[model samples]
Target: MDKFSDMTLFVSIVKNQGLAAAGRELGLSPATVTARLQALEDRYSVKLLNRSTRHISLTDAGAMYHQACLEIIDSVQETENLLQTGTKEVRGSLKISAPRDIGKQFISPLISEFADQYPDVVPYLYLNDNLSNLAESGLDIVIRYGELADSNLISRKLASSRRVLCASPDYLARKGTPITPQDLAHHDCLTMVRSNEELKTWHFQDSEQHNVITVVPKRCSDDGEVIRQWALDGAGIALKSILDVQEDIKQQRLVTLLNGYMKNFNASTSATGADLNVIYMSRQYQPKRIRLFVDYLIERFQQL
Candidate 1:
């Protein structure tokens, strides 16, 4: 038996959760599915599954092998699709998730442009502050900001987004600009609260020295947009991502503060990490739709 075919069949059986179901999907009988599985196992001299009459589960080795099989299958499919068309023909749905502020301000319009370019590709975007599991939520990509943790997911840096401390001119006129990070404690800070936790602390770096300071905020909000708006209305000083406040800074509606004492602190809770990123599960056999979307985003962000 062809090992790749056997691997695909085995994957199908695992996905379907039964030989009978897998057989139905592949147009093979249950006996044939069992025989193929046995042939594969015997060839490897290992038990791939722990099977009961009614259910089955992968052994530890089987789990590892299954992951490899998936990667192999995806690569094959990608190669076949490319060779068959002899051109990049993108068609399929791309499900994506991103932070609310960045998604609304940047990603949304870019996605619209992508749609115009690849009309055959359908896009589904979810914008929220909460992070969702890529596999469980069935997302094709997640565009996020900040330093990323080490994980199985693949992450590519699209751009560097820095967090800026700013307040409206009127707010500064009334309260005066903070001369140092410590002065934030004396000012009426606008804080962002998420997951029921108030983020009252900000970190700063000077040379090789690190300073973490806590502030007292008169205004607290769960929505980042709300905090940004409050800062615009002269409520208090707020920390915001450059992407969200770039236009405001350019227009001089908001004046950046503490530039000298500022640290490139990325406190964003997005799973993909602090710096702007295009995160996905695997790129081995990424579909045309996803590939093009990722490329478009990278290009657009670079221009930004």
Candidate 2:
């Protein structure tokens, strides 16, 4: 039991990056955490961590030991989870991130229903338009606008949606719709800005040829919702995801443009699998609540 406690302490320190933070998280005092870590090192007769005044890092041996400890802890937790949760209620904290428009329009309502069904499961949703690193954000899921190339993560398509050019009917009526991709250079365009860079370049392809046009944007923002609202306000034409503006088009508030040309909504030259995806880490084990919630999201999105 002492050895197991030491292993837990070591992992906590590494994860928290300090003895004091680990102690706070684990409900222990800083001195207790320091003593337990020192005792583990003394028992092994080798230093596992290189600690500075403000930071801590694992030695090579400590890195290997941490990996082993993780495996052991995961196995034990799996066994305990299986024993305690046999045909029982699924309950856990589910942390998710998404774009602001989608979160408020779709995910937020579904989350309300989902929470009513599983009252014990807590949900946390972070809404921002800019792309985020799921691992660095400590979020369980990230809903993004496109597919990712990382093998460590899984990007699952939630809806069959594509990017299209659209703008408010009033804007198009005044600006007199662009005839070709080249004409966009002369028209007012709303674009997205990410990482302090303006995404003003647009890509279009038809069976005949591929074309790239760099439009001078009249307005730009980090939030897609802002750009969408601007386009609705007759600020300029916008290249947007179909799922986002479908209702607006149906209501005749916005009109789809350049139907003959398929515009690539991605910022880059290449296209990703989908315009929107629900991404999570690819792991051997996932909590039942997360699995159920993801499945529920898939089911609800399919209804759209």
Candidate 3:
């Protein structure tokens, strides 16, 4: 292996604490990893690691070398990122993440349109309901609801959004539409279970009344898309983001319930993370591809 590749392997070995584990991570066989490490140590003429049957520990020299390796690796990555700033040519991979429902219903078409305009730029879009770390996940942008607490990340509001209680026409016809938040107690409700806790309690506000009601969910799911599908299938009433069900409501597939008594929280609600936002890592320079895509997304959402 080359010097830089050896440095990378040494760092991985130290991080993973075993030759076999680092081999598995880097897609190298155990024998190859061992040979590479031996070659690296010979080139340095130093015993870099103390090895046992089950684990490896860095020698004093290895510790010093490990820190230098980290710096070099980070510098190389930063230099590559800096290269994007010099070119007006927008051609690279744009990795994006979004909630499943919004991704399917809105972001997917927007990405398709963007791709057509910039055919040289590759799009890698994945639909996920939970938050993903941009830097760790190597994601260029994440479109999600709710406010972010991380100071190292920058977020821009794409649109103001809120959840609403709605049910399919058939479900309402069978169970009857609720006129007040309390009426949900007597109705079968579909709720989300996130992080092992059910989001069964819903909040409402009106001109003269504010209420919080916790309904016993008749159907529970961790997937927002599943809950939406259940609501559409006439299984039960569902509290969903309007963004996820607006077209359904407009098509009269699902009807809004408790219009006078329930005020679904908006994107800025501190009580919940249900706002539409596009988030990226705070960087000294963003690639032209990412900047253009973010601007494009913001403009499109504004017209909504």
Candidate 4:
């Protein structure tokens, strides 16, 4: 008898509580089911099931083996599903949400590439600085930076970037570089206001001690790009992501300040640190388009 077939019969017997019931469900005779189970036991040289007039139960080893068999069966089914649906032409609308800066700088290009690869897939990309609920927003996926608060959404880490304190070379030359967190009070801090009610607070570490300092901004705006541009134009010092300002720093357009004191800040404010993640909802089964897009994003981010 096939080993897999015998294992299936054994599992069905346990689930149905008897060989007769399992045989009825499987459209086989009770004697055939019993024979299959006995063959499996003989192959393993262990008695798997304890039979009684009124009840059936598994031995200790049988329970462990049953769980393993179930997992293997599940994996086989999943693999078959992937093979059958993997190359099916993905034609559908996919809605994605991301923060404004990341959306424009990174996600937009990814979407364009994804659309080109699967021409039938239409993408609706929403870019906003404000927090938007994925389910309520009707999004297929959300690219979030930093910590997330929702426990229901499934998140996959894509990449990581550090938030660093930066200023233009000219601004630093005029104001002088701050060596300590305390010196930020004397500097012209350019703050990025997230929302109407949000306050801009900067975090730093000194001698392994952490501090959260609220800066009285010399210039403030809700737009991150605006503050970043202002810093580039030598208006004031701004805290920004390393990835966002990497080229500028490389070109000496902007210079990092208070390097020893700078630490990662949680952009979402719910957590203490930041991580770039791709979040999606749990379903009975994920569609091909959703899986493909997420895999593509992860691959692209990993390459970066």
Cα-based TM-score, every candidate: 0.70, 0.78, 0.73, 0.67
Q: List lDDT for all candidates, in order.
A: 0.79, 0.80, 0.81, 0.76
Q: Write the per-residue lDDT of candidate 4 for residues 62-148, one digit (tens) a residue.
A: 766765665555455557656878855576678898877778888999999999998978899987766654443446788876676
Model 4 CA lDDT for position 291: 89
Each candidate's number of clashing pairs is: 7, 0, 3, 0
lDDT per residue for candidate 2 within 194-301, as digits (tens), equals 889998878887768878898998998988889899999999999888888889899999998888876875434344544678888665666667678888988999
1 against 2, candidate with superior lDDT: 2
Clash list (residue pairs), candidate 2? none
Q: Which candidate leads in lDDT?
A: 3
Please identify which of the two predictions, 3 or 4, would achieve the higher TM-score against the true structure.
Answer: 3
The runs of at least 3 residues in candidate 2 whose Cα sits more than 4 Å from the true structure, single-residue gaps closed, are 1-87, 266-272
lDDT of 1: 0.79
**Considering TM-score, which of the candidate structures 1 and 4 is the better prediction for this target?**
1
lDDT of 1 by residue, 1-304 (tens): 6889888898888877788988999999999999999988888899998899998788868766776776677567667767989865676678888877888888989999999988878899888655555533446789876664638678888877667899999999998888888888889888887678887888876655667888887999877778889999999998887778889999999999988644443433343334778888754556667777888899998998
Which segments of candidate 1 are over 4 A away from where they belong? 1-88, 264-274
Ranking of all candidate structures by their lDDT, best first = 3, 2, 1, 4
Those runs of model 4 whose alpha carbons end farther than 4 Å from true positions after fitting are 1-87, 262-272
Candidate 3 weakest lDDT stretch, 10 residues? 262-271
Q: State the weakest 10-residue window (summed lDDT) of model 2.
A: 265-274
